[model samples]
Target chain A: MKLSRAVVIVSTCCLLAAAARADEAPLEGQVLVLSAASTTDAVDALRAAFVKTHPQVTVDAGFAASSALAQQIAAGAPADVYLSANERWADFLDEKGLVARRRDLLSNRLVVVVADDSKLEVKRPADLEQQGIDHVALADPTSVPAGIYARQALAELGLWQDLEAKVVSAADVRQAMQLVVSGAAEAAIVYASDAATSDRVRVAVELDESLSEPIRYPVVLLNRGAERPAAVAFYDYLLSAEAADVFRRYGFLVMADDHPAADAVPVAAAQRWWGLSRDEWLALRLSFQVGLCAVVASLPVAIAAGYVLARWQSRAKWVLELVVNLPLVLPPVVTGLLLLFVFSPKGPIGGALAGTLGIEIVFTWLGAAIASAVVSFPLMVRAIRLAFQAVDPRLEMVARSLGAGRADAFFSVTLPLARSGVLAGCVLAFARSLGEFGATIMVAGNIVGETQTIPLAIFSAGNRPGFEAEVWRLASISIVLAALALVASEWLERRHATREST
Target chain B: MNRLSFRCAHRFAGGFALDAAFETDAQVTALFGPSGSGKTSILYMIAGLLRPREGAIALGKQIWLDTRRGIDTRPERRRVGFVLQDHLLFPHLSVERNLTYGLRRRRGENSAIEASRVIEVLELGDLLARYPRNLSGGEKQRVALGRSLLSGPQLLLMDEPLAALDAPLKDRVLSYLERVVEEWHVPTIYVSHNASEVRRLAERVIMLERGRVVHSGSADELLLEGYSPSGDWEA
Candidate 1:
């Protein structure tokens, strides 16, 4: 009896042990790292090293301008780490108590880069004053750290006053580099780290460090709940000797100190009165007005086409489907170019419109919205078609059987069931319209308030000098809006699905 | 004088097809068949919901569909009604709105049917304001029927209207259908498979097997011969 009791006690002990093991299973920690758009390489290099040391942890990294990253972190992203290109963001995080430790772990140098085979003669800072230079790319001095440094260098060289008119603000330093590489701009100011990552652009000159404020990157450990240990581990690993080598290899100078100054600028909260400048607000409101117009404008055509696709069973369906999906498949820039080629003042459609109707689409907000709508129209049709498909054809048939004509049956039955899908499609189209950048920028030049939407504002702000805080503010607002939109769509879809099943 | 009579043929992609030529002087004539034998297509052809490759359909004095003369009437102007296999009631609109849609379509139509008479005939007096979502399967079909009838159509095309209901519900709805046919006296093309239902509801039967009409005879004659169109019939 004692032996049997001992055996039972042992079994119970094993069960308890197994339960304890389950309870003590290794914790899951996700570490988010936000890096400036141009510093993607540096951030990636640092993350790779840190992750090597902590293989159990998952890292979520986003690359945007330092200003945009700061804005996103400020807007309550569950980030565990923020690595900004300059001290401004670290200081902002320090003020909010979001940063575990404000440390200036790295320094970056600013340089002007040009495409390798460019004809533009840009040898020195003063050479930028030369005539015939149509476009010069830079991060907006207001928000991006690299752009701020570039502006300081230009100011020190007395080039800022002369270069203002020729400048085109990009959303981030990386995009600025792209402008130079794509031959869209004559030259762009980017980080030495950024220049090292691309082979298409050649460094024109490294500006004297003394001409600008010292480029310091502050590394902060975010206080994300339930992930504190992993966050701190990743943070500690960043300051380790091995990670410092990676930073140095990537053309960044590791700073001895990592502390945010008490007098650093406030991490600006998202500005909500549509959270845009007068020009940006106008663009946003116009985007809405135009998006609604575009959707309404395309409604008849889309409805007719959608019906043909869904119900007609015509032999020409394949051709129509291809046309409908063409805008989606083509690159935005290509779509913009196609529009430009057709709508340029001298182009065929443009010539007709301008010559006959006294209307033009060149560099116009209407044009931008049209381009946006055309590119996004497929999404609307697809959503609407799905809604129509969900509706039972029998309903219409029943109406006909009751002495209702075909038109009567359609009005009574098929349209109602497709309501939810149509609404969803409209929302999707509207969002796509608001966020459209490339096609809008190409088709409608970044004319402030006239064509500059929030995305364009954020881009230009990132490129503009002394507009960093504003860029952060706008980015934060956009992120919040986008998140809200996603949540709403998800909730709406779930409710509809539940109703359909029940 | 006969108010509604028609003959039509329908062709689809591939060779799978249906051809029918019939005339009905009575209130109801059923085109009975198994599933997917082109019964619905025939109803669609009659209501002008579908166009035929080569056929003629005339309702009273109106030439609805004639391929040779290139005279095809739109479904909205055909003035013929239809009821489908499943009750296709609008979930968004109330029963009253569903009934009024047809009235709105016929705004200039002088002989438009009365809404009150339809409500009374279909026994939907209490359910006029409710939505299709708030209705039973049988109730929805009744509203669908009332809405169609209120459009002032010359004829009705019903494609297995009670196929979705339970046996008890079908019986209850069938009796209401009988009242509609008798009181309205509108010519109807009723499609069904239930032999008993066809016998009770229709005066004549045009039986289709595969895609061709196998028999066209009085309901009693077809029942006695077991609906075989094999002897001395021209190919």
Candidate 2:
């Protein structure tokens, strides 16, 4: 009996030791995770729980629009795991052999949201087209996963064609929600999780699953991190019950082992115009309008500033020059944000204008023009200043001796001599404006047929799956336009030189 | 003819002080001095292009500048024609457009020198359609001279007008200058360091040395007494 008891104790002790070993396997080093912006809060909670059990493991997380993160991964960003808002980006990485393993981690439902104070009755998908719904915001349907899903659901319900005009695209789902909250948009179609985060918006309707492809968040282990034990541990921890509980708390649908199959929804065919789809053409047209308007509106001010910078001799001249060139040296996004502060409805300039003229600028084409103008102003002023400086000051003095007044001499002699530089400045500003995205997106809010310029269109296209052709087309057009502007500017400069030399 | 009386005291940043006074009613009065002797500054002051610290300048009855009275007419209203050393014609305008530039400012007043007469005397008919960038040095100077004449100024100021030209070109341009003085007979202040050019052009000479007037007399007396036989005066 003693031997039998000893044998039992030994076997039980061995089993208990093995169990302890399995639970305490130390995970060391760093695991970098790139996640969708919508899943940031949930991922943070999951990371906290994961580090508690594996104290040696450090979790570093980055969150942005899923499509942008996927692009970054494809460009060889040092990311071990990617949690995409939809399966498309994961599939994109998988097709490129960048994803080592992937699984559907969570599901989310689409909801149409309106301001909490809104009295409009929106019962179904068709209700989006009802009267008083002037503008509907969505994630960029061409590129962003949320917007693609929203576009699919709208197309499935046959309301896309009619409601397309009122749809304004945001860079991401969070931005779409913010659009509704800020009252820049009357309505927004966003993930249920995103809607829950905002108190200003009320969910009007939850879209049925049958209306579009199943909205699934897929967690992926990238090939770069497949060999790292810390990354593998973090990847497994993301799929554990603790992580699922956190996701569920954040209004995400925790996927079961047996989830619904993903159906391949047919993409709607786009109508073509001049070898480009209607939306692409609209973006191109809007880019031209914004570019021309920006150059025309800012030219007089730029010329005057250029003249002062070139000719004025004073201690305060450096300060004027610094102010004029500030936008050039600053990051485009920062410039955009500064412009937003000055041009928002509640902003000083915007408030006075709106109060007196009843004219709003935010989310409008004029806002896009203003953003482009501000960003391109430095380039214009620099070129024009150099041009004016190149003209002989004695020419003006001689004109004065010929009985011409100060203003007369400038108009007749100085302006004619500096015409080439002025023209070159215009072309440069136009090109700069055409490629303006960061600031324009910030102030203008990417409204289709209104503020969606070529760069913005390319950004939207770049974020969508299976829109590679459209992206290439828009990108090529931009390249061609920039090349032509540069060539024309060079030709003008050369002509000016040859004329002076002769 | 209106007599021009000018007296000025000015100090340049380089410590060059100019204190001189003269009066002339001659058709061509020469400001004879070497370069950097404040000759250009005096001519500029007379044209209202430069301001003196204290000065009184009168062309006949009109006061172009008087520091005591605070009467400083603008350069354009002073109607003093200036022929720059470089003949600074508008590079963008055609030769004809450059000649006609000052005509636009002479509205309501009848111009004594007609465009046709100036063009005929300067022989600029062949260069009318050409731009200044295409013109030779002598041609540019002729255009500059004709441009000034057409403005019908009360006085003309020429600052080393032949300084940029070669010796051969200078002789040809000098003949053109002689014709302008003999034909239009405008009261003129001509600046030059070349004594021979002054002898050929000026009735009276104000000799300057280190920014001060050392002598003032007929061109023959000043050039003979102060200048070397080589017709060049050294500062």
Candidate 3:
């Protein structure tokens, strides 16, 4: 049933492929080409070619894991085309009748890769089951297209059962390959196209064609393209012989030169504040979760630090201050790198946690929250310390004279006096945590549903070839949330100021 | 006789040395001294809020401090109530809560002062809900006195508690203080530099100069104009 659809799409593309450049003047506006992650280089190459003939047209290409790209299209993200790595995701949008045009453009081969220094030998699919072979990283098979294809290939070879226990599922094909690079997994099975991009690993074995399912890249023009003529011209250009040659240069087999929303979404977009794609909504929701967890987790420690800094009289007080403020002064990326070293599987802290406690932090939502808490902790401590300082020590002395214990005096009198400042500190910390990116990415890898916070989503969406629209959507959500938190913090501080006068 | 006996050598920083030794059993013994003459310092030491370098302070049956024995009791456990010049009423609490704060502490432990009795004595029924921030200087001092008295302390130290009030307010609060002493019969050490205050309040006065007690006499004799700084009494 899918074979018929590809054939019809090719014949349709061939008819307009030549005529697409006949009048280049009409292709002056932007043409968005949305594709899977593996096709970034190839898509760039095609855009370069198309620009030589139609220099007036701008082709914005975005790339991501196929399923994520498909969900974006289904959520009515404004884009001109969809160039996907597998048939299922395209079929997903097709079922929703989102496809205005569809075609098969390319095919890819799968290979098993191992680190360059490893002694482990996997000459065939069956060789992956050796005794020393620990984890085999693969993109999540239940959902990710690459994992789905890898599963088919392994099941055909009868190798899936033996390796199932050793599988450490990655979020995407690139991440699967990265697992081997970091020595977290002994081997990873990824597309030959992705394998060519990295030099740290060698393709130990390429699975035979008969054992693997036929890998196909499909391209679709969504209903949003009807608004832009340049988008349709670019869609036709993708199926041209010129685009096929560029695909081959990127190590993708040139089958058809295989490759791999806007108007309908305007009503939802009109809502402005409430309008959000599912992924954007999730990003907002996850940001709040991470922010709240981060603040809640660090509050006790922050309060203790605040009290000590405010009241403790010791020579080492300056040292404590410096240590609390260290994260604020250090570059966030440096902080992330330091966290990665401690939390990575081979690193001291992460190794013990994973082995002894069965707690996994790397590439998980918990790790993201911890990273956020660390960065926002200093601000909380500083504000709380100021609040503590504002309270008169004599009040506590009077409380003590009234037969109140130190702890009782603190809770009843001191803490209540400083409540406004402490509340303002919490709001500021939450807002800062929501925007945290560098430290978060260092400790928690960007896994869309699990660890990808608002900043992470904005970063990846902006970098993706055609997902610029998604970037704006995520960015706007971040801005709105942060602004609200600031307003709340400001209101609390004003209350504190007014309290001081009375 | 009921008494407070204490001896402290206040060789504090900045070369300020106080060699003080006193034993008083009078109904009211005023710590009469100018500023920086260690009057409030003695009151704080008795209250257990401040520690002296070397001292043994015992109020009748209880030993409040014995630095030689390493028995410096915590202020909260010492059963000593202090009302400083500023009143020092907890600004965050209402008059009722402040009054009951110490009363709550002594609960179920054979407490002497009752919260309702304190409320009636201080006339704080209308001011129960009002915070210290909203109270006048005299009202605050009354509340502070009420709070301390309600704690059922063995020793009550007033370090010029009415000094911040105006003339009329000071007289009014002073009468209340006199009534408290007459009614509760708590051992009171009222610190005052004013001659009129010493005459009006203290039955006995101990004059202090340069951290030394120079005179021990009735308030009337101490207030005589011919009372000299060159002491006739040994300090």
* Per-model chain A TM: 0.52, 0.52, 0.52
- Residue B71's lDDT in candidate 1: 94
For every prediction, compared with the true complex, DockQ reads: 0.19, 0.49, 0.41
Residues A1-502 of candidate 1 have per-residue lDDT tens digits of 3323533554465456435433643434556666666656556557666667667765546566777666645644345677888887788877877766757787777888888787777778888777757778888777878778888899999989889888898878878887886678888888776677666678888888898999887777776622568778777877887777666666666677353212212112234544455545665565665565566556556656666677867688899999998988888888877786777766788779878986657555567767777887887788777767776676665455444566656655666556556656666766667777777766665544345677877876554323556777777767876676566656655555666431
lDDT value, residue A449 of candidate 2: 53
Query: Cα miss at A101, model 3 (Å)?
Result: 37
Query: Candidate 3's residue-wise lDDT over A24-138, tens digit each?
Result: 4243376766678777667866887887898788665555688876775564344679888899899999899888998888788899999878899788888889987889988
Cα lDDT, all candidates: 0.70, 0.83, 0.78
Candidate 3: residue pairs that collide: A61-A465, A61-A466, A62-A464, A62-A465, A62-A466, A63-A465, A105-A258, A105-A259, A106-A258, A224-A261
Model 1 residue B217 lDDT score: 76
Ranking by DockQ: 2, 3, 1
lDDT of 1 at B162: 85
| Tens-digit lDDT track of model 2 for B1-235 | 8999989999987888999888999889999887888889998898888899999999999999999999998888888889988998988888998999887778566667889989999999999999988899999999999998887888899999998999999999999999988888889999998888899899999988888888899988877874673566763
The best candidate by lDDT is 2
lDDT, candidate 2, residue B123? 99
Q: How good is the docking of model 2, by CAPRI class?
A: medium
Interface RMSD of 1: 4.1
Per-residue C-alpha lDDT of model 1 across residues B194-227, encoded as one tens digit per residue: 7767777888888877766878777877855653
Top TM-score: which candidate number?
2
- DockQ score of the complex predicted as candidate 1: 0.19
| Descending-lDDT candidate ranking | 2, 3, 1
